[model samples]
Target chain A: MKAITVTNPDDPSSLELTEVDTPQLRDGEVLVKVHATSVNRADLLQAKGNYPPPKGASEIIGLECAGVIEDPGTTGRTTGEEVACLLSGGGYAEYVAVPEGQLLPIPEGYSLSEAAAVVEVACTVWSNLGMLAGVREGQTVLLHGGAGGIGTFAIQLCKQLGATVAVTAGSAEKLETCRKLGADILINYKEQDFAEELTGRCDVILDIMGAKYLEQNLKSLNVDGQLVIIGMQGGRKAEINLGALLPRRLSVRGTTLRARSVESKAEVVRSTVENVWPLLDDGRVTHHIHTTLPLADAAKAHALLDSGEVTGKIVLEVGEV
Target chain B: MKAITVTNPDDPSSLELTEVDTPQLRDGEVLVKVHATSVNRADLLQAKGNYPPPKGASEIIGLECAGVIEDPGTTGRTTGEEVACLLSGGGYAEYVAVPEGQLLPIPEGYSLSEAAAVVEVACTVWSNLGMLAGVREGQTVLLHGGAGGIGTFAIQLCKQLGATVAVTAGSAEKLETCRKLGADILINYKEQDFAEELTGRCDVILDIMGAKYLEQNLKSLNVDGQLVIIGMQGGRKAEINLGALLPRRLSVRGTTLRARSVESKAEVVRSTVENVWPLLDDGRVTHHIHTTLPLADAAKAHALLDSGEVTGKIVLEVGEV
Candidate 1:
């Protein structure tokens, strides 16, 4: 089987396409013949040696993929079923072994490429913002990096949950894209100061840039508001004012889904299948695909993501099984 | 009527016992002839001008008191009811007008002085740790300043709720008192590093010294742990590593009950009356009153709290009605 491997953790350019033996199925696992896989910021971090895959997971790049079941392994399902798998690693490969619990049936009416884009972002947004932050109906949400993969999906999910969605993106084009995706408020971060323009407080602030926006994010929160931080693209450390957080009864939470335990991942996947997959099937939520590259050109895919020009998910279309 | 007034917000000795007009009751208000008022850390902050009474509350120092109702105001309850009122302010005076909703009947076996100690700490711990943090049975909790008023109450309440309680205090004497209050693990913060000495992670960290323990507190939490900070005895600002918080799925929340709105306060009071008062009634929870000073000796009471020698709560006993 062909796969994208990180030979050295230096930069995205280090990603190489190489031939590797298909992964062996383990108990409670399935062998997925990858149709398409999506790139996440976490993959960039992993490639740069900043992040490591969970223990006993494949050291390949992708975190999510849409594929077909070659063998059900220990999972109760039969072979040759359509599925999308949330992976700790190995999604960069043609055939990856995954725990059955991490695999979701491709929702009706969604293609494999679209499902590939939907799985990682939807799961990430739902687990971090909806479940952890307890973002409720009629509450306002502030999404940072609003035109990116996670931010795009977060805008849709928050809107579906009856929240007023506000987004911050770098350019007018990205801001317009977010607006068309049902964002109630869009701030071109290059031109406007989000903290100043946002007069009212938000119930939840889903942040991708960590330390850079820490102070301003806290300032933008309402009393008892929550700031759910999923990424630290800006920097790692910042001065936190404990006194400021007290009067407003604010909470700051940081989370990542890729490195979580299998049980935890299974729980998130189960919840997503129950709540979000239906929304996708009913056309209430849609996946935004930026572009697709051949599996051999995973390098170009990563470059597109690194360039920051891609509005939504960037996928690698592995050869059809 | 006589009351202790803060003539200036600088010195603790500025608290002066002076004759003032007795408070008049309003609709749905009760006039309580003050029997005893407890000193909280907030009182010290109020005295030092670091904390101020919430808007619409009297510009007085006291937060909780136990006394007989001289008049139930227009609510039509008979006079002379033994009650403990969670006051917004004015409890330092000879007479304080309390909302009917804020008054709770004194537990059958508890005396006025003990009940005075109970109100402030009970309301503080229950609202922050219990209601907000959702502290559950069998989880580990770390309570900072565990011999102080809120700490002592937190230790007892966490124990009663079937949690394993670890407490950090300044001295051996304070640790001993924390043990007496049912703390399972006692760490002398002066001698031991709580983050290092604690072998297991805490499910909830009830912090009073905010910035001082921020880093160590984040390290001490288990996955999905909650750090509930109620005071900033430590400096207010410090460097926070949001990266450290992400993988653990931890939440850091800062809350203060005094500055909360009346509706919010009433909600807290209602929750306490429903969930915690029964424990007080059944003698499952007990209050520890360190000492009592005459109303004129409020400065002395402040001195005691400021000196940090007193364990449990200090009360200021006003004259008879």
Candidate 2:
């Protein structure tokens, strides 16, 4: 099996396409022949030696992939079935072994490359914005980082769930992308203060920039508001005004997809398949792929995201069956 | 009607026993002849003008009272029914107008004074720990300010709900009180570090100390722990490490019972009556009142609470009906 391995974690050029032993399938795990996998901020962090995979997880770079079930090690599915999956660090390879529960059938009419992008953003948005925060219909939700992979999917999904979506993005082009995805209100964070610009306080906020946006995010929250923090792209620590939170019944929940128990990841996948799969099958929430490159150009994918201009996800395609 | 009025916002001695006009009952409201009421921290804050009553609420300074219904304004109970009520304001008065929804029948085998102590603590604990946090059996909950009104009630409630309760208090005597209420672990905040002394991480924390304990509370929390901030006895602001929180899947929620809308308060009241009143009736959770004083001596009660020696609640008893 060929996989992307890091020679010097501190260097972007450290990632190299090299031959590695294929992972053996553990009990309740399945071996998948990966068709494609996408870059995530987690992958960049892992490459930099800042983020390590959880205990017992594969030390590979990617967090999600689309693949065919080569060996269903446990019960659920048969060989040769198409699937997309959330992963705990094995997706940067031709073959990866994962717990069967983390796999989802590729939605009808979607390409494998498209499916690779879907599970990561779909599960991230659905779990954080939908499951944890419970952003219901008719309520308002403020989504930060509106042009990224998670942001693009989140805007469409939140709108589909009957919420008034407010988004903050850096560029007019990114904001335009959010607008096309049914974002009701768009704020160019570089220009306007989201707290001041947003008319009504948001019922829910999906925050990626952690400490830098903490206070303003709190100010923008309506009574009984929920703020779910999945990514900390900004600084890590900030002063939280508890006086504001208590009176308004505000909740701050912090989450990550990779470190969670396999059962929990499975539950998120199951529901994402049940709920967001249909939206993907139709044209309502299309995959927003910024660019695609062959797996050997993993270094290029990292550089593109590091430049911070990618509109959505960047995928790495593998050799076909 | 006689009530406690603050002559000067800065002076604790400003709490004066004086005659005030009887409150007129609004639609779906009930008027009660006060038997007794309890001194909560909010009363002190309101007396000092540090905390103001919510819109359209009484200017009088009390939160919970026990009384016989003088007028059941719209429906539910008849006049002369004994009830303990959660009030927006006006609980300090001899006569108070409350929405019918906030009224809870006095549990059998308990006096009106006991009932007065129950509603405030019960509603606070139930709404924050039970409802919002969803603390279930087999989970461990760390309760700060375990000697205070909410703490004492929460310790027993958490115990009755099959959770192992850990508590932190200022004094050994207060910790002893918590022990009797089935606190499985006790950490004297003045002597030991709760973060180090606590045997295991907490699944839920009913927190009153705000900024001062925020870091330590996060440390004491287990993976997926929930810290519910109902009071800010410490300071209101603190630095939250989103870095630590995201990896652990921790959630921090802030809430207050007083300023919530009538319908929301009613929902808390209804759930308290349904879930907690049974525990009270069965004697599994007993109301813990440190002392009961004459209503005219509210100044003395406030002074005692300010001295920070009183364990559990201090009740103010009105003159005979």
Candidate 3:
């Protein structure tokens, strides 16, 4: 199996395509021939030694992949079924072993590359916004970095749940993209103060920037508002005035999907298939693929993401199995 | 009307008993001849000018009072009925005006001083723990400052709700008191590291010390744990690592009962009347009053509270109205 392996974590360029043995199947696992994978910010962090794969997970680089199941383990499902797997690691490989529970049948009418984008974004959005934050209809939600991968998916999901979506982006072009994707309000963070431009408080603030927007993000919340922080593109430390949080009954919750336990991840996958897959199958929610690069051009994909020019998910097509 | 006023933000000695005009009642308000009033930590903050009364509320001390309704304007409740009222301010005086909706009828056998203690703590605990956090039976709950007014009530209420209650206090004496109040586990924080000593994770952690316990409190949480912070006794600045929170799906919420809107407070009062009042009436819950000082001795009461010697609520007893 040819995989993107990290020999050292010093630099992003350290990611090497090396021939490695195929992973052996565990009791509840399935082997899949990788078709495609996507780049997430966490991938960059892992490349730079800032983040590591969860204990006992594969040392390979991908967090998600769409592939054909080679072995469904004890499950009676036939081989070569189209599926997407939420991997702890090893998604950037020719073949990977995934927990059968974390594997979802590719949605009807969607190709394998499209499903690659779905697993990561669906699992992330469903767990954070839908399950953790309890986002409901008629509520107001603010998505920071709204034109980015997670933000785009979060906007669509919140909109599907009947929420009024507000977004903060760095450029007018990004803001326009978010608006086209059902964002009701857009704040160009480069030009406008989101804390001031936002007229009323939001019921939920999904933040990617950590410290730089902490105070203003808190100020933007309504009573009993929930702040779900999934990324820290900004600095990490901030002077938090708990006095400010108390008066509004605000909650600050920080989470990342990468390190969750297998059982927890299985639950997220199950719930996502049950609740969100229907929307995808019905064409109510669509995946916004920014650009697809051939798997060998992985460096180009990384460079594109590094430049921050991509509006949505960047997929790496691994060729037909 | 005689009331306790803070002439300056300093020590308890700065509290002065001064004669002020009785507050006038407005539409949807009730004027009560305050028979008893209880001191909360917020009142101490107000005394030190760290916390100010909400806008349009009296610039006086005291957050809750129990007395006979001298007049109920516009709303049709009988005058002279014994009631407990949640006030934004003005409970220190001979008379206080409160919204008709904020008044709850005194339970049959509870005294005015007992009701005074019940109003603030009951409203605070029931709203934050039960209503907001949705703490259920068989769940573990950690109560910080577990011998104080809110703690006493929380220990009882959480026990009544069938939760296993763990508490942290400063002394063996306070821990003993909490045990009698139905706290199942007690950690003398002065002697032990609560985060290290707590072998089991809690479903809900009711925290009073904000930044001081942020990291450890998060460590003490189980998957999907809720950390409700209501005070900032340990200072407000802390380095929050969001990465630590995501895998466990933990939520850190800070809330204050005072300065909330009338509608929200009314909802809390109504909830207490419905859910908690039965427990109080049935003796399943006990209001722990540490000491009652004369209205003129409010300075002494504040001084005693400042010393942190009082185990539970401190009430100010006004003379016969």
* Best candidate according to DockQ: 1
Top candidate on lDDT is 2
- Write candidate 1's Cα lDDT for B199-315 as tens digits: 338999999888988999988999888999988878899999988888888899999887788778888889998888998889788888899888888888998899989899898
User: Residue A267 of candidate 3: its Cα lDDT?
Assistant: 90
TM-score for each prediction?
Answer: 0.97, 0.97, 0.93
* CA lDDT, candidate 2, residue A293: 89
Model 1 pairs whose backbones collide: none
Error of 3 at A12 (Å): 2.6
Alpha-carbon lDDT of model 2: 0.89
Could you give the interface RMSD of candidate 1 in angstroms? 0.6
The digit string of per-residue lDDT tens for model 2 on A216-257 reads 888898989988898898989898888988888999989998
Accuracy of chain B in candidate 3 (TM-score): 0.97
How would you encode candidate 3's per-residue C-alpha lDDT over B1-321 as one tens digit per residue? 788887666564677778789998889998998999998888887887888788999998889999998888787878888999999999999899999879997876989988988899999999999998999989999999999999999999999999999999998999999999999989998889888977438989999999999889988998778999999999888878776676677888988888689888999999989999999998999889998888888878888888888899998899842
Off by over 4 Å in 2: A74-76, B74-77
Model 3 ranges off by over 4 Å: A7-11, A14-16, B6-18
Model 2 / residue A47 / CA error / Å = 1.8
Residue pairs clashing, model 3:
A255-B246
